[model samples]
Target: MSDLGLDDLAAELADFAPAKKKQATYTAREERIIAGFEDIERFYEEHGRLPQHGEDRDIFERLHAVRLDRLRELEDCRTLLAGLDKHALLDRAAVVSMDEDDLDPDDLMAELSGLGEGDDITTLRHVRSAEEKRAAEEVARRDKCHDFEKFEPLFKQVKDDLANGSRITRPFELKAEIRPGAFFIVFGQICYVAEMGEVFTNPQGRTDARLRVIFDNKTESGMLMRSLQRQLNEDDAGRRITDPAPGPLFADKADDGEAETGTIYVLRSKSDHPVVAEHREVMHKIGVTSGSVEARISGAEKSSTYLLAGVEIVATYKVYGVNCQKLESLMHKVFASAQINLSIPDRFGHMVKPREWFLVPLHVVDEAVERIRDRSILDWVYDPNAGRLVEA
Candidate 1:
């Protein structure tokens, strides 16, 4: 068989489009086969070699095997390709104007009617049966209820506190206050508190008895209220006052304030702020990873035995176009600037000792290699090399 014929066959198979119905029916395995064939064909053109096969097989058998494998892969690709094509067609169809000749409303209605009223009735019956079964299961589950007696006291306490107009204070010094006849409660955060009035109401014009609020202590001020009705049921009773501290109370503010009419004062906690907490965590993490190297050398004598090992100094495009001699000279200058010592061995051969050495973490060496991997390099000097700089 001619190789050209096989190539043409492969191309034709790849370009072939399946019908919509057939596309939907295509298996995932079939699509994978088509994809494999395409890869194999591209490989054949690039490397001029076929996939590995039994040496004992003749050319015809080898080609047959390859074609069979490619066909399987093509089937898989075709399924996915067909789905993409269908989606593209659908998108195009969405923007296109529907012609009257292409669609008949009456015909569609007649076709739908052909499905039969009995079919709809049967479907409804099945749906109702499922719903009934679910309801029965739910009722049975309710009958097998777990004992909540242990949690009754805690739940009762929360209910009683809300009914008694009590407040709960959070760690951030924010307070949530529950008021009588209130649908929603208010809470203070930072210097301010949020108030909710007439928020929850029943359709019959009755307000909810329970009120709850959750607030963080990191908000603005000016959201407290006073109740005119003291005894709720009693006529002409004494009023109850609830108020937050006035305007921008900073942490540095004093406790003393001028007596204002109908005003109340609330103090903030002396706890560290969020920003301070975050800064402390960051410093802790850094200290755990890299102990303060600069702090260790502070106030040290000049004659102290300080050995700095594993100093990795990497340069990338810095020496790109420059010759080795210039590179060495530049490196020596950098070392001198960094206050690092430099040494070169006599009787130089192909390699030379690095011009400078300083102590650095092993991780730093890995980081430098990763950064300059794409750049031009004459040599990779990891260890100390001693020799006179030679021109590259």
Candidate 2:
């Protein structure tokens, strides 16, 4: 039997064995879904945290947040990526609240059906995933600003305000923040929201409006309100240039927008003092007053409190509900670690020590104001070495 023809035995065994099974290969569409999730993995690896969802978050991060949310919820995705979840990615909190209303409904439908782009019955046209659709939409459409002359001045003023710290920049947060007359820095360019068209709901049941945004370069864009929000959130340096803060918001008999009682001003000295000259970028005098900032500093050079020199106003914040003095005190206490020590002679020649001037940067002052506004300054303190605010 062993000697019996080898070819005949092989043929019998080939017919007897079960047909050789082919190894599973993913479709292009399936590959894409995993690829998108892989991006989140890479982000987590780079950042050491799962992507969290919010309009205030970066655009790509938000997309990753949405993608991660799906990975946690979808059975197919969880199963396919179960082996690759070395970081327990799929097990993290999937409760990230995302505004999925604006997202294309077809995305969810295709995901649920577990079908590839090639499985379409009617048309062989390629179907794009939600990420692709969004990536394509990221390219903002710019048009010629017919009356760029009018907006050119506003842009110049904002740049000047930003430069002098009269106006400060904050992270871009929402679509609602993009109303007419608002100024934003997107991709390092000044984006002035000139006019807003009528609000309308798209087919996706999301509120939207068209905006006439004028850029710094005399170029303009007719981008949607949400599109600008997306662009700003996606950009690392995108920021909103705040309007000059209004006075105290808690004043009695105050009409809307008339409640501001005072402004907080930051001043840089023109002193010939060695320390002041050496650390000019980080030195600042912080104070609050119920009158005009210009009027407050009218006789700065004669006062030792002003470092015995003319002072340049660098930043200002308007107070609303809180007392200007109290808010000023709060900021001083928080930045106590970075307080500047300056002993100067008054007009009478007696030495005087100034207390309000600090050894912190302008951006740190901006953060303090934000903390004061949010009522969180009490829980934090300034770290001069790190040059940032940290938990107290």
Candidate 3:
């Protein structure tokens, strides 16, 4: 089949190249849905659990929890994000099975407040839905981290340190020092302070500095130190990750009224008693200790302070630059409504009353800790019926 022009054709084929492929396009709604789900994934990775819905939960977690619910309901959303569900978050959700037994269109229509018919609904003229409002505050808070590669390894190491207990998280103290190279957990994300700018007097005559903060979700914020302080004080779960040795928060030396004390430990009673068994999910013994918690509770079952029950260490919070006794008293007063009322008899037939036991949920306890950090616990009281800390 060779021809006179075969040599020329072979030369042209040698330089043949295909055109570059164009990037795929996605609708904004689709993109936002994926972005929202990714937050849930990051939450799972950092905390090793799915984001939960509760008034007591962090705002970011609450958003993710709501987003997860919506994703599970929409087949298209699940299909779109199927490839990225490495944690089977969606798969586990299916088993929960949100059953809709009532065949009432009127009830269904009542819940779809912002939904409208036809393409007009897609226009910006529509009011923001309640779900959007819940997440809108933070959805666009940070820009994409273009230089994420430079900080990814640091994130990995911090995560490892947390897993091994080398790094610890405590409530972000009010007016707490925010400097470069510090790690923090804020709004359900790992935030790294990459750089700190020159300190300048703010409008309120308070010292403030601009920060280059990078989030583990591949987002960055050029935020101010005072703004972060205010945010952390307001946020129920905002925490600072302490350094490995001689931590910035817990140093060898502390100034007046800022002494590094002990830790706040939450223990779950393992007692087989009816009262303890009934409220075990929410029952926790809150205490402060300067010594090791393990050593403190070694023979917990033998003591009336522990309700003559073996205890499981549920959580520990490192207290820094604060009076432990005052902190412990503040928490007890905050959760006074949920305080356990019992008169269990000891082995010697002596009636014992456990004062530190609280019927409040763990997350609420966490919120209490946040309030204590900023001394806002003074104005807040635990509402047992509502299961949250409310204005006193």
Order of the predicted models by TM-score, top scorer first: 3, 2, 1
Minimal lDDT window, size 10, model 2: 106-115
Candidate 1 structure, TM-score to reference: 0.11
The lDDT values for all models are 0.26, 0.67, 0.66
Model 1 per-residue lDDT tens digits across residues 268-330: 111133432333221110000011233322322220111112111122221121122222322
| Backbone steric clashes in candidate 3, count | 0
Q: Could you give candidate 3's per-residue lDDT for residues 127-170 as a string of tens digits? A: 33443433335547779999999999998888666534356567
* CA lDDT, candidate 1, residue 333: 34
How far in Å is the alpha carbon of 173 misplaced in model 1? 48
Off by over 4 Å in 1: 1-25, 53-392
TM-score of each: 0.11, 0.36, 0.40
Candidate 1 lDDT score at position 55: 20
Q: Locate the minimum summed-lDDT window of 10 residues in model 3.
A: 98-107
Q: Is candidate 1 or candidate 3 better by lDDT?
A: 3
lDDT per residue (tens digit) for residues 1-392 in model 2: 56659888898788679888897787554555666677678789979998865322443455567667666666777888887788898887643444342222222221111122333211112223443334334322455677887887886677555433356566677777889999986643467898999999999999999988887555687888988887667654567878866444232234576556678899999998999999998899887776688877777776656776899999887765444544566677888898887776656565556668899989888887777656677799999899899998
